[model samples]
Target: MRLTRGGKQNAKGAGQEMGGPDKEKLVPPAEGTAVPNGEETAVPKAAEPGPVTEEDRTRSEEGKSAGEGGQEETALAQEDGQRRPDESSLRSQLEAVQAELKSALDQAKEFEERAASLQAERDEWAEKAKIAYEQFLRARSDLDGFRKRTERDLEDRINRGKADLILALLEVLDNFDRALEAAQKTGSAQAEGVQGAYASADSSASGQALQSFIRGVQMIRRQFFETLAREGVEEIPSPVGKPMDPSLHDAVAAQEGGGEHGTVVAELRKGYLYKGMVLRPTRVKVIR
Candidate 1:
């Protein structure tokens, strides 16, 4: 029995060694473990993320610059729109000034045309007045010439009438001279002696009266001849010895005579000249 008991103990000891739990093993804690009251709660752990690359940083900066540029362009467009109306108004004012200048030039040209026409009319009137004055001067000269000619003709006619009146008075004086010459020739023939005695004895008482009368008549004839000679009445020369001048003599008869050709033979009636002009030609006989 002792041996058998020892074998069992040994067996049990081996089993015990094989079947015992390990003393080094961990145990789970209780659900409400106590912590310090003032301490903060536990933070969640951050998840692991990707690293920053060069291309991602560049894209972010470009987007920020483009937004700022868009704002500046919109402001400049508004300012250009405001200035457009002012430029249009200034162009309209310049066009109006040019139209006014053209109107003034047209008015000045019209005034010049009117002035030229008035000057031409004045020159024409002045020329006409000068021609009229020249015509009046010519007419005055012609009238003066006619007046002088008329005065000269009137003076010539008056002188001719006075010459004709003087010629008629000269003819009456020539006839009175012939009567006195004939009475002187008869008285001289009676004065011869025989005829003188017969003429004195034939008178009776009346004869004595006639003899006294005859003597008285001889004295009257001598006185009349002497009075005429003193007063520029003289006989033309009719000599028997000289040649006959036709200007002073009228031949009553022709005869063969003692003198030369065309000589005076005898005087029939005496001729007289007054102031070297013939009053009457002498009547005479001439030798042919």
Candidate 2:
């Protein structure tokens, strides 16, 4: 090892003082040997560390900070990598739940629409049923009224027929009463004549009374015929001297006569026609 500049100068001075021949050249101390100052030395002081500068100290501090920052960044990156798949799975599950909720809402709306349609149909059918019931009630009422009217009309017709029959019989009773009055007058005149006992006068008065009775009978007959005509009854024409008609004449006897055969000789009973139909045929004698 080489000695320091200061150590070399000291050795040169010592050598000169010792009266050595090589005074200009100085020998270095051996490694780890004792120097003349009683201090052990291994190498020259020139090989020792130099004084630290501000720039160097600053650079060392910056390097240590950069290393610590790099380690922290690496740890954060590893933690992020480990959590990525869990975040993706959570997002997917949330989307699926949203889709299911949307579908359920759609189904509920459809069901509400169907229920509204069914309610409308039910109301329409109820209206139709109400109309049908009203129609049935009206029809029943009309039928009942018709039946009542028919019965009333039938009863009225029967009552009118009975009235007509009674009227006809009353006409006959009136005529009979008139006939009885005339007969009573004739009997009273005959009794007076018989009580007086005058033969000639009695005969004349009796003839006059008989003629009056005959006139009354003829008047009654004419009045009866008028009543029958008013009731739509008419006498058939006399069949005497006419050909016998089986529809109008009923032959009661036959006689040999100067007239043609099958001819009516005399009418025994009067025939009547009511409304152009035969009510009674005439009883007649026909010529054989």
Best by TM-score: 2
Model 1 error, position 88 (Å): 66
lDDT of 1: 0.59
Best by lDDT: 2
Error of model 2, residue 133, in angstroms:
20
lDDT of 1 at 114: 76
Q: lDDT for every model?
A: 0.59, 0.73
TM-score of candidate 2 versus the correct structure, residues matched by position: 0.36
Model 1 scores a TM of 0.31
Query: Residues 1-288, candidate 2, lDDT per residue (tens digit)?
Result: 333444455555555556543422334766776587874444423222334445545655666677788888888888877778788898899899999999998998998999999999999999999999999999999989999999989966864674467456555745665666677777667666666546577577786777677678767777866876786677789988889999999999999877899999887766777657676678899999
The sequence of per-residue lDDT tens digits that candidate 1 reaches over residues 1-288 is 112333444544554566552233333334575546744445433322233334444544554465677777677767766666666777777777778777877777877787788788878888888898788788777777777777767755653453344334334443444444444444444445335435655434444455665556556645654555564445688656577788888888889856677888888777766446565678888888
**Model 1 — which ten-residue stretch has the worst lDDT?**
44-53
Query: For candidate 2, which ten residues in a row score worst on lDDT?
Result: 44-53
